[model samples]
Target chain A: MRPYLYIAKVRMLSALAYRFDVLSSIVIQCLAVIASCFFWIAAYGNQQAALGVTRDQMLTYTVMSSTLACLLTMNVENRIAASVQKGSVALDLLKPVNIFGIYLWEDIGSVAIAFLQNAVPLLLIGALFIVAPVPASAAHFLLFILSAAFSYMINWLIAALFGMWSFRIVRIFPLLCMKGHMIRLLSGSVIPLWFFPQWLQTVLSFLPFRYIYQLPLSVYIGILSPRETAAQMGIQFIWILLLGCLFFEIKKGVTRHLLVQGG
Target chain B: MPLIKVNDLVKEYTVIKKGKGLKGALKSLLHKEKEILRAVNHISFSIQHGEIVGYIGPNGAGKSTTVKMLSGILSPTSGEILIDGLSPQKDRKRVVQNLGVVFGQRSQLNWDLRLGESFELLKRIYRIDDRQYQENLAMMDAILEIHKFIHTPVRQLSLGQRMRGDLAAAMLHSPQVLFLDEPTIGLDVDGKQAIRKFVKEINRLKQTTVILTTHDLGDIQELCSRLIIISEGTIVEDGSLSDLIDRIAPYRILHVELYEEAELPIHPLAEKIRQDGTAAVYRFDKKKVTAAQLIEDLSCFCKMKDFRLEEARIEDIIRAAYHKKEKLEGV
Candidate 1:
């Protein structure tokens, strides 16, 4: 608990060191989301609706997903992989604590700070420009929270799994970039799943990548009913639990190799 | 009880050999070759409670590998290691509580935070009680003079200051066994002496057993009583430092200054390493050719102005051991 708090304090302080990086990240995200909001509003200037989504609902989805993207720009994989390359991970391994726990707690601490100090402020600015959807109802709010929890697990596992690849190569960044881009593009992080062609949307629905972006956005936009949202959240949890196990196993193997043949 | 025990510890490595330059880099992409390296060959040793032992080796002689295994950072390949009677690999978190380690090339302190903050963080990680923490801090500050820069971040601390800070950090929890890997490296004469003094003091005061691995022969010569020298992944010699030097390769070197320029001495028991106008260096076998006998022969043969007898230094003895090891390996 002490180390966790200590590390978290450092994690929080690190963001404050670079004020411009935080400000710009928030500003760019807000402006881009607003621009997209206007583009959608103008497109549906006179039409009643498009594909069961109203102009207001689409605007709501736009604001929330944009905010969520900024909120969840963890880049945990990049951090861990960079540590691997720099040999800093060796220092962490020497401590009398669980390496996995330390990384996980630090991840939570750092990302939590990023979201509060960067993403929340950006979301507020987006709300000033457009009507961000509040949750449709109390029941839907709980469902959305469940979905977001699942969403976090999926992102964390994918990032950790890629990070463990440092044993194989010095730089996992380029590969992480390519893989993340593919996931973002398919999961509708840069766009909305509602805009995708029907078949593509259906295929994306069956993939776990949706848990990272589309499902959270969909629930916020009132796209799914109570039962449907529950099912989606369940799927997200199943994937999280399953991948979490694999992530730990790979980490164990990678740690062993590192300790034996240290850089 | 033995504070540290290792049995049949082994570590094998596969090294990727890549050529130099652009052509070699490209060729490597198509056909990559690997070389097998056995770092720590099958070996076993145990340190009893409160024993300060020196682990010595030539470069690439598996010193660090063995330290890593004993400290619980690395898992042995085909053996068992028990520090305080628990397998480090099986129960790393628990085993780590019983051990403290310092690496010369690395510091565990936070780079951007004050030394106080770093110590506080360690206090939390090790979960030291408040009363004990304060007592230890006071004792460390008195011995290490850590108070001067307790507020300074680790990056701003001098190398000597940082070494002391690292020592304090490793000892914050007051573990039973301390593993120091080149703790005195890259320090000035004062810094080295200060660290050596502190390590010795703690071993005496706290009865903290220390297994130190160092290339600095001076540290070994000053601090350690028991010595273990390994080369080519095998433990070539293990015993008291003086005993190893005595049993094998005990030779005294003699330097004689002639009253006038003279030719080198020719003898079966001694070999002339070099000779100038007035002085000549002769390496003599103390077992067969005594220094007294060499002196008698030199006095009778030439008009000797002066002569000096030198005892074998640990560096020279260790060098001989390493070279002898290489010869045996036919490397």
Candidate 2:
């Protein structure tokens, strides 16, 4: 346990080494937050009733979505794929530690960095200038944090699933991009699922993507009461349990035939 | 007991056979043809404690494959590997506790972190206590002179510096058995000498058993007391370097330069192989005639200005072994 925490610490230091890169990404995410705010406000178009969610609530959803996007989707797939291509992952195996465990700890480091560097800033700016923030209560904020933690786990499991495919596939860029776009579209980050057509909403319900970003944002905007939030948390836990099992199974199979390619 | 043991180890990989061009690629996509590559095949050897044995082979002769299996990086398809009385496949964690591995082409250190920071991370990962970690770092720094660049990031370090850093990292845990795959590869003469000194000191002081795989003959000559040569996934030669040379090429060449041009002398134990101007070269079996005796017989018949004896070169013997010469095969 201490060793894994040290790995997380090292990863955080590694991320901090590229301070310029993190700062630049923050700038881009901030721009995205502003653009999303304008787009949603324009869509509301002075209408008091938009899908029964006020313009203020929609704007709040936009702010939470931006934060959730940065917090959850870290693109750990690209880093894993590159390491596979370099054959450096073999070194990771030499240690007594589990390979996936290291990746999880590393992702936690990255998520923490991303949250502190990007998400927190966006939430502060959005709450200050972009929109007047209102949480249903202090308990809702606490529940949102719990839901967001679950969302991060779901996002990591999904990214790891894609990352493991690089062991077999030569080109993982297209697959990675597809995952990004699919997550953005289905997670209601691009547009809240409340406005989606009935059939599309039905299809999105089957996926765990929305639970990662959309549900957490919904909880933040007070769209769900305490009872609904509690029930959604239960559903999120189920997804976490199922995906965790699947991820470990796939990882076991992958490592059994572990082939370190390239040099 | 041998510190490391292997019996008929084998590793096979199935690779897809891809064709060239558009039509061939399309056809291959429809019907996949797979080929099995026997990376390591039925090789066996054992090493006692405190021995630096060189594992040498030509390219793709399964040197790395064997090391990978022994180090628990790759599993063998069939065979048994016992490192210090434990099977690497079945008792990997226990075996790994007593093993250290280094690969020349790649490093285990984190690239973005400082050298000391990387070591600290490894210290935690390996669970080295504070006192032990500090002692190991001091020992490594003394030998590697790593203190000068310990604060530098791994990516920023020169190749030699990084290699030293890698070597130091591998030794922090002080495993009983060390597997080095080209540890001195791509280093300058001084860098190579530093590594050689480190390996020697570690083995001498700690009784560490080292299995080194390298193409560098200098490393073999200066460090290893034993050599294991493999080719085509089989052990072609395994013994002391001198014994290998003696078995493969038993004769030594004697060159003599006379004061003046004279008729080549005939002696019972030597055969004149070359004669040019006033110089003559003879190939003689050392078992039949000693160098001193042959020179004494030659000086009795003629005046000799200069003379020298040359044994078989190691490079030639290894090349001959690789080619599977009829007499040298299975020797």
Scored against the true structure, residue A172 in model 1 reaches a CA lDDT of: 71
Chain A TM-scores, per candidate, are 0.91, 0.95
Q: What does DockQ give for each predicted structure?
A: 0.49, 0.68
Off by over 4 Å in 2: B326-331
Alpha-carbon deviation at B302 in model 2, angstroms: 0.8
Candidate 2, residues A154-252: lDDT per residue as tens digits? 888889989999877757889999999989888888788878999998988888988988888888888887788888788889999999999878876
Error in Å for residue B115 of model 2: 0.5
TM-score for candidate 2, residues paired by index: 0.96
- Which pairs of residues have clashing backbones in candidate 2? none
iRMSD values, candidates in order: 2.3, 1.4
Worst 10-residue lDDT window, candidate 1 chain A = A254-263
Give candidate 1's whole-model lDDT: 0.80
